[model samples]
Target: MDNLKFENILGWKVPEGSLPCWVISESERLFSIKEKKPFYDYSPCCYFKITQRLDNNFIEGHLGHSEYKGKRFHDDISTSYEYFSNYQKREPVYFSFDRVSLYRLIEIIPNKPLSFILKRVDSPKAIKPNRAFMIMPFKIENLDNFYQSYIKNYLKTEFNIDIYRADDFNDNDIIIETIYNQIEQSEFIIVETSHPNKNVFFEFGYAVAKDKEIITIQNTEIEKNLFFDRAHIRAIFYSFDNIDPFQKQLEHY
Candidate 1:
């Protein structure tokens, strides 16, 4: 992207026959830029509600209008609305954000003009959710499954907010940095208090200091050990066999 030059991002587009084009609004555009800070100038009630990130120079997430003019994205990113939007297909697609123009404000429309500047990369085993972060131990039985299948699905479906845990990403070279990044990106957090982990507490403490909306989840069987009481937030206790109580309690948040 450094080599390619474009003054304005809106004028950009995915390349011809590229994985697909995802014309991002001003909000998604802010994420692609380095210096500017306003998320989006205009959006239709954040209806599309999707997220994307540039990792290893590749773009990942529900690339097509997760900012949905539709339900899901297909290979022809230009189309594929009104279907199950599954960017979480166990494997993630990686693409690149490109620019064809030299100036932000200037448009050089050729005889055959095109704007999309995204390139597809065949990367695998990576899924990212930017809205919420989960801080729980990986060692817990079926806990990861509960998060991925039940919790992640519910939040994305009900609230359009995607949740991710540290283990969700295949890469953890700089584990602490990644954890901090997720915390910073998240609008809220769902942390576990059952069978508490020290590192989890440390991260939770950092989030508290940052003034993030924190929600705790714990198994009913485990006693709350050295409970953290900050901002008067309490943990939502649920049973693995019955998640009904947790679902009902989450609305209070």
Candidate 2:
């Protein structure tokens, strides 16, 4: 075990009696936006034990949750991890987990693994699995109708896959939390970048960091204005008069 590189353990089953692991984060714990006040209440630590090796890039595990009094609150919770190496980031790779909400594990004990798992926990209430997440500027003019007519209807009717956007959530829902949750549940992401929107870019970055399948779309008018760095990326350029081709292009993904 001492000589094992983190990458070598990718497909190795975590045997019983292996050391317990804790996920530590350098970043501050995020709170719900609906509170209107920041609450620095929770610890940045999460405990878990790897149970089974899913593949070269993922692992199945049980998450540990303890109460304030040091009593174990939850154990053997089913979860899966997405390896950090998949994203090809220069920064310290972190494990992204979807449990009560989206969270990351920056470090682990025993052996510091190069790859971290993106975990998805099963919710008590079954959520309809989302096919794609639409990341676009919500304030764009007549965009809702366009989404309703072309994007949403097209995906549903042609592929039988549901798509969600930030606007679909209720007003009471916390904005960032809801966005992360939806992205976690989605199999792929579709980003509209016709307009240079900070929020859209942020979402796109998040999706990329998570190594999600990304499909970018842009309006023909502003296609020249796309970020120079991202120009090489293939994007579907569409117009109001002709969106069928774009819809058909999405079907292959």
Candidate 3:
């Protein structure tokens, strides 16, 4: 980004010896008047919003939807319109201010030219959402069928989140690795501490190490002997009749 050069910022009213700030405004192009103190030159299309930063990087604000005209931008100063109109689709008009970063401007600008300049602005590597998460419930066998049914049914109904059972683990490390990776990326995790299996405890610890937000539930009575910190991590205490309570706890998770 340091190697890239940007045009200029508009509507910046920065005091000398200050950092940059973002603002919305009506009209004014902010720049170094004498390469020292800043000033504004009000023009015809000078109606735009301006926010001042300690420094001089100004982000131009529009009141409403606008069109990226060939050499100018057309926007309303009252409300944000539904969508901006189409322009001649020529080169983007870059207001001349000095403090804004080129990469940031590229992101804010529309109709940017596609070439080496754009390649530097748009990074090819980025993460995508919509990946599925798998969950594994511990002590599945020890729990009564009613309890198992309650856990599975409530998880899907309340959160609409899914998990794969640890029992599904095959001899393939690739499968296990994929499952673990998905868990690390999951938005929320649930670990049933009910009559814990060794693997479940390991999974719980792994989830904690990964800093995954977790919801812990236990069917057994809360153990006073457990460390206070561990007890604090528990999200819910559930029994046969306490399904509603469990659901309530998960509703906000």
Give the per-residue Cα lDDT of candidate 3 at 121: 18
lDDT per residue (tens digit) for residues 1-253 in model 3: 1111111232323222222222212121223322322222322122222222222333333221123333223322212321121112332322211112121222233322211111111111111232223244534454545434665555666555455454543322123433554465466567766553676677677778877777776664533244456677756767665577766775666
- Write the number of the candidate with greater TM-score, choosing between 1 and 3: 1
Q: Which candidate number would show the highest lDDT if scored against the true structure?
A: 2
lDDT values, one for every candidate: 0.50, 0.54, 0.39
Tell me the lDDT of model 1 at 97: 25
RMSD of 1: 15.0
> Which segments of candidate 2 are over 4 A away from where they belong?
1-99, 102-130
**Model 2: per-residue lDDT, tens digit, 63-179?**
433222232313212223222232234333232322234334332332222223444322221134556789988756677678888988888987788998987763321356568
- lDDT ranking, high to low: 2, 1, 3
lDDT value, residue 205 of candidate 1: 90
Each candidate's clash count: 14, 5, 23
Backbone clashes in model 2, listed as residue pairs: 80-119, 81-117, 81-118, 82-117, 82-118
List the candidate 3 regions with Cα displacement exceeding 4 Å: 1-139, 142-148, 221-226
What is candidate 2's local distance difference test score?
Answer: 0.54
lDDT, residue 235, model 1: 66
Winner by TM-score between candidate 3 and candidate 2: 2
